[model samples]
Target: MVKSKPVMHKAGHLFSFVLGVIFVIGGFLATYLKGLPLIEQGKASKNWPTTKGVVLKSKVASHRSSNSNSSTYSAEITYRYQVEGQNYKCGTVWFGSDVSTSNRSLAQDTVKKYPVDKQVVVYYDPQKPAAAVLEPGVFKTTYFYYVFGWLFMGPGILMTGIPLFRWLVRVGRGTDERGENVAGKF
Candidate 1:
């Protein structure tokens, strides 16, 4: 009984690892591409000038309890505006340190800053006017996500591709030699 060498097993592992990495990269790219554009489009659409809106409601929702003493809050805001001669009401929950005066003041300040029935500008997508947000500045933060995404993605693809290429070269050479061996045996 001849024992098969472990090269074939390693080759399979290399192939799987490369494919898995590509799958992850594809997923990230898809998400990043889809998300980045929406952010940009939303920001650009804001340049069209905000339509005046009447604040319908404003409240703070506790997102998480931190250290049992402090908690994170999300600002829930709703407003009514007219789009294409029709009235519409849209609301969104905005979170993050930038949404507030200070990190510690996230929920409280947000709720207080924009009070109910306050007249303010609302930014909405012209194509889908129903999808709107009270805080349009959220798009600015997308720059960081874009930077970090490329940073990790570039290296990940390189690391995965190099090993797979080497494995393919080895497999090709092995198959060529094996075929010669069989021809000689016959």
Candidate 2:
């Protein structure tokens, strides 16, 4: 049983190290793959062509959590615009606008800003006119995923780095003060 304890300890460390690596990868993917694109798109949207559009539907949508007694709110604003004689309907207010928040006031404020039938400027991608948004440019939410990535990466670096650093130190020393080989111990 005593022997098994050391083996189990090593196994646990190995698992944690692997998990940390996964976190690092996941964080990078989240930042670059998911977040960077949104930010870039949002930035590009600022230069997109604009057209007159009317709000067809604007309201706050509430969603309840499945696992807990909690709810989130999101602004569900639908607007329609015409580009080069082609009409397009979209619900995007801004980039990453689909994300819901625990703050109901934010959603409510959005709904109040764009009531139904209100005339608004819609920005559309010239390459794909069907893609559009009411508000352009990167907002605070644009950095959400990018910052989220660092959350995972920070811990991952510590987990993977600490063990590797210890191993390096052991390798450099080769033996402890008592002349006991410590290189095998990481």
Candidate 3:
């Protein structure tokens, strides 16, 4: 039983380290994904080449949830553009990319800006010509990613830092002439 206690103690420390690493990685990944929209938009504005595209299709798709009997709507916009005699079809119509909402009117309003056959400007990534967006801004969802990222990261740092800090405190206190653990005497 005594031996098992030490094993359990070691297991606890290992668990804390592994859990902290997982949370930190997830936090960073979420933050990175949140920033992708802004990065793509910024890149498009500065150096991405643009071409005229014809709106092949534009509509609001309302997807109903069977569980809650609720619906979420998204503006579905598909356009085709040609670059250097090569044609490409892109479905990314908004800066936020397929901006969706629970409010049907919001989706409908977005679709109006790009009716079928309407001519509009399309921005394409120079390196990957197929990647494009009609809009170049982020949505409210972007902030959610950032918020969740920090929520995970805060505890992650605490989990990792607290152990290291406690170890340092113990090591520092051990140098005292008493040669006794402070908490142990108490």
TM-score of each predicted structure versus truth: 0.60, 0.82, 0.68
C-alpha root-mean-square deviation, candidate 2: 3.5
Model 3 agreement with the true structure over 1-186: per-residue lDDT tens digits: 256876888789989978998888888776677655454464455457789999999989988878877888988889999888899999886555454568898778878989999998988887778887776545564355667777887888888888777777777876332356665554
lDDT of 3 at 108: 84
Off by over 4 Å in 3: 1-19, 33-40, 43-47, 63-69, 137-144, 171-186
The candidate 1 region of ten consecutive residues with least summed lDDT is 93-102
Superposition-based RMSD of candidate 3 using all C-alpha atoms, in angstroms: 5.3
lDDT of 2 by residue, 1-186 (tens): 256876888888899899999999999998899899889989999999899999999989999988979899999999999999988899989988888889999999999999999999999999999989899999998788889998998999898999788777766879653457976588
Whole-model Cα lDDT of every candidate shown, in order:
0.63, 0.90, 0.76
The deviation in Å at residue 142 for candidate 3 is: 4.9
